[model samples]
Target chain A: MGETIDLKLHVWRQSGPNAPGRFEDYTHYAKAIPTHASFLEFLDIVNERLILAGIEPIAFDHDCREGICGMCGVVINGRPHGPRKATTTCQLHMRHFRNGEEIWVEPWRAKAFPIVKDLIVDRSAFDRIIQAGGYITARVGSAPDANAILIPKQVAEEAMDAAACIGCGACVAACPNGSASLFVAAKLGHFNSLPQGKPELDRRVLGMVTQHEKEGFGGCSNHYLCEAACPKEISVKWIAKMNRDFIRASLRYAPPVERKEGYG
Target chain B: MASSQVLSFTRTAIGQKALVAVTGIILYGFAFFHALGNLQVFLGREAFNQYAEMLQSMPKLVWATRLVLLVALITHVVLVVRLARRAREAKPAHYRFEERMDPSEGILRRYARQTMLLSGLIILAYIVFHLMHLTVGAVPGLFFVRGMAYENLIYGMRTPWVAGFYLFANLLLGLHLYHGCRALFQTLGLRHPQWDRRSFAMALSITAVIVGTNVIIPIAGLTRLVGGELPEDPQEVLRTGEEKHTVSE
Candidate 1:
């Protein structure tokens, strides 16, 4: 339903963390281009075109090429998914872009986020923080059936939703303060919102938030930007939950006696 | 990273919000009191100027105030930066640019993170420029001259930039107070069933006083790009009705 178009892309290219970075430009010329071509497919065609031209392919990170993976993320001109809600890069189609548009695509910018080549960032920090107690230690013995424990459906649904976080760091990358309260809260909320998670919820939130602070991330100012950018549509309301949990834990929960400060 | 030092920001979404709120309250409290105290300068150039003179005159008090404020300011800033860093570190992928009516929107809306950034920068810039304009103009320690005394504040504020920044400072302070006051109460759980209105009212009043006083002084003193004085004590703000009528009559 639309005419074919050509566009220029300015992408961030870096060899590694300690390496200097520069913007590399590529032009895509295409015909019979379906307006509905997914963003990744558009990139696929561009890469194919480059291959034919004997030019080095533009390097970008993507997996699943589907919205679920959260691997194929780019700001796309100036939006997380080219200005859509609950959509990831793979779901983003090229119909959003017009002909001859100059797109600036860059990786997440933050001191903690060391870039690994093109748009890929070293996001192991997420893993480390997650490992710091984003889960529950309340073991459900096999003797108990799933029905043995009663959980309110609303609470269960909320917990499942919080648990839905795919560990995508889009929240952090989207923040002006580079705050990770949303991700941390989602993880904290995942377990805390459930009955099985009730026992260690305190310890989990305390440990995670503490680890988060020590990692040099800025604190949330409660702007709720993370929710908007999150492909999972994780509500930043979990941040409110996390804040309440941390405060409660500090006052009541936490280890019976404090260990040496920062030991864990 | 001690339990005392760390204080946990990523615990829960609500918990993070609480931290934002609690710290915000602390910061706002300090600013409100500081601004309210600064308004004493308008009570008469001599009394106001003398206040500065007295402050510089006492080493122990000055040092104590500086030490205390430095600790407070540092702690506040560190917590904010640390919280922001943790949030960033926890996310695997970050967003690209998103549209905003203002930079302070979005996550910045949490509790004036953007305003904090802005006020922090503006305050930093103001401090340097202000010190250069005031203290550097003097022999550093002197900070005062018989001619260029605290009385010149109005004249000083007469400049658009100075007045504008002061107004900006007041607005920023208001933003800081708006969320922070409620947060402090929420953090301490001081909201009893009976005093909810009173508590919020107190917080709102304090903010209004600080913002209003700061605003009125600049506008009143520099209304004609010149200096004016208020009689000593807090009740003399109405004496300028002569000039008010001078404009009308």
Candidate 2:
């Protein structure tokens, strides 16, 4: 597919969200692209040309050329990066493109994720969810020394598996509902399987879900699309776990009643 | 070490999850019960309407519950916000992300970040409109009537927009619960290799059932697909083996 794909690109051109936003179209000049060139590499060629022409290079989110850092996220032709499995935009190579293709690249379009620039957004809503639904409350010294807790090997591996999320906004960009359950759940699973994260487990789950809802992410439709789009393949299982924790906590919880001490 | 000076590191991937677990459970649990409770409208106006009346009557319980929920909600948001901020802060500039795992990636076991976000957002919108249309009417002394949930339910359904939204949201909820319940089990360390397949299927089916049936109910009412006097038992149709399976994941 390295045929120097002939295509029209509908790129999101917003000076800022408050500023006007428009879709600028450009035709490919047919630069001989390597089939192995990652998608971003292809963009680099375009950016170089724009710079030479004294144009502001297109701004999109990307970091750690490797996929782990979770910096690069964009909707390419309505898909979060070109269609691929367990891969992010940075890892996406050029081979997926055909000789002639009309591609659309846009920043994550969601209410909560307002655009900061061309493709950057104030994705602090994700931060908001983390602040509420994250963490197993532990007093530093209270945690046992590293080896003191012998968690089963499988549990550790699974927890590590959940911990692999890179905080990319692809799920929001790809989700029809713009949900963020996967991101929140991964954080939930990583700590809930261990002893150190137990004391405040109930409180943590309750807090995160509340915050997640406030941020305006859509609900999961059980379509498994988010799992499919996920770069890290973080799993819906953690979310399920989050649900369970909330239920159990609810059953056991007795709302703290603020009394009017002087009179009822 | 002075407790005040101690830098209580608030954000980490592990910590983030603990928060998700707690919050996800509460939200999903509430939704499941709410869906189940709302369907009681078909049990005839008297029974269903009375239920709402009863819940409204307990001001103390309701107040206490709301207070506690507000606090818990605040705490959850605090944790998520801190972690997300740090993650963003750690990256002074935009970075790229890609998936590396292939055949090894478990369907239900991976992709937690995106899924959680999607569900959280959808549920949020649903909650707002839901409370506005359903609960607020009664509390604000708006158009709500005593012992008239059936009439209210039908009237709301008659609006193509409301029915359409309810149907759409329920479907999304189903998709959400499918993996959510299973993920919950895994996070709690309850998954077994031998039964994983069975569990996943079970989880998927439960979400499908809840979302599917709930959507159909609204559509049926709106479209006149199934019309008759109120049924003797509404929740009976929903009785399933999966009720226990819904306990997170």
Candidate 3:
């Protein structure tokens, strides 16, 4: 004996970013869905029904079908990842919703993220930001012995906290200012705070921030919507750390190769 | 070479924000000291005039300081306007039903964020008007004299509308400074949880101290606590070298 909720969906439909977009209404039948079903699972049932009815399934991006992938995202009822705190769309369950509720679903809307089709959006802008300076340039070799390098436990924890960013673009999607400062800061903090990643710190920050601006992402004014919308609950402190490191790198850094060869 | 690197750094978003933070620090220092200096009025007319004269005596230093402030102000305003425009263009479509992404943020933080641009513009307008009334002696009045800054301040505040506007402007300035400090510390990477535990308190207290002193001067003048009975023509007082006018209070 399971409970089911009949519902209506007003989902945005679009062919591409350049094409016109509109919300198409769909009504779910009185079939009782399992009360324990996840929101995605509910969507899966609706999509199945649509396909069987000779209609195209809603296009959305999801992988791993879990919260970790950071691939699944949609603005449900005018909220990024639905009306939940620190929860991603894939992790959201159907039990959170009331029966006969009309859920409005739309893709993440930003100049940097263009809608592809239905709820899917182009997030390659985030990939470009990562490619700019997201990785440490350390030489690849057999895994170094743990504890070979002594890093302060607190520093390591902070770096790990910053590195938890999944590049979901939720920060960008959720920010009222559409600022990517949080994302850029996360990438910068993950590396700048680490010893192995220290050498190219200045260049990495400069490249990523330049790339972020080029991607048309807005600047952060400490509105902190990203922190609230984050599935990982990444703190705005990392952004502050990034700003500090960026300023230092901008002012004091000289490429290691440019150091004096021999001082007389 | 470092200067050149700094110049190049100023081209990015973080760089622009760092400029705002740095300039904001300078502006904060100026406002804090300016409020402290203006509070000399409560010590009576002689003390305030001596303070004004001391500042005016160092013409070169005063001019240099003014020029630096002008440059910093322009840079802060320009960069902020440009960034605000960029933020506006970032999201063309509006969310129909907006929900609080973070409900934990207090009302002060919300007020600071939403009112930043508006308060900044209002403060800018106030600065220009204030300069006209006192600094430039350009505002047509019987009391605005280039060297008589104390009298100018008192006379300006004697008008209820002017005094009221000053009070309101300083209140907005308090709001701006409160948020500006919080944002600056974050932007400059100066925040540490140990010290940041009191960041809100620090910001609020600093704003209150500065704006509190500033708002007092106009209130004092409007209520006739200082320089209440000065005649329209002060030739007799000037001839007698009684520049230090009597204070009833």
Q: What is the lDDT of every predicted structure here?
A: 0.66, 0.65, 0.82
lDDT by residue for model 3 (A110-228), tens? 88987888889899998887887788877799999989989999999989999898888888888877888888888888888889888778778877877788788888888888888
| Lowest summed lDDT window (length 10), candidate 3 chain A | A26-35
Two-chain DockQ for model 3:
0.42
By descending TM-score, how would the candidates be arranged? 3, 1, 2
**TM-score, structure 2 vs. true:** 0.53
Error of 1 at A84 (Å): 1.6
**For model 3 chain B, where is the 10-residue window of minimal lDDT?**
B1-10
**TM-score of model 3 (CA atoms):** 0.89
Per-model DockQ against the true two-chain complex = 0.16, 0.04, 0.42
Fraction of real interface contacts that model 1 preserves: 0.19
Per-residue lDDT for B119-234 in model 1, tens only? 66566565556556555553242223343455346545655666787777667766666666655554443554478689889988988887798777667655742244433322
lDDT of 2 by residue, B1-249 (tens): 111221122232333445555676676555556667767766665677688788878989888867766666666556555555543433232212223323455664455434555655676587677677765654242234334556556656656778888887776666566656765555443555678888778766656656766787778777755334534233432243146347544
Q: Cα lDDT of model 3 overall? A: 0.82
Query: Which runs in model 2 stand beyond 4 Å of their true positions?
Result: A1-7, A136-145, A254-264, B1-249
- Of the true interface contacts, each candidate retains a share of 0.19, 0.03, 0.63
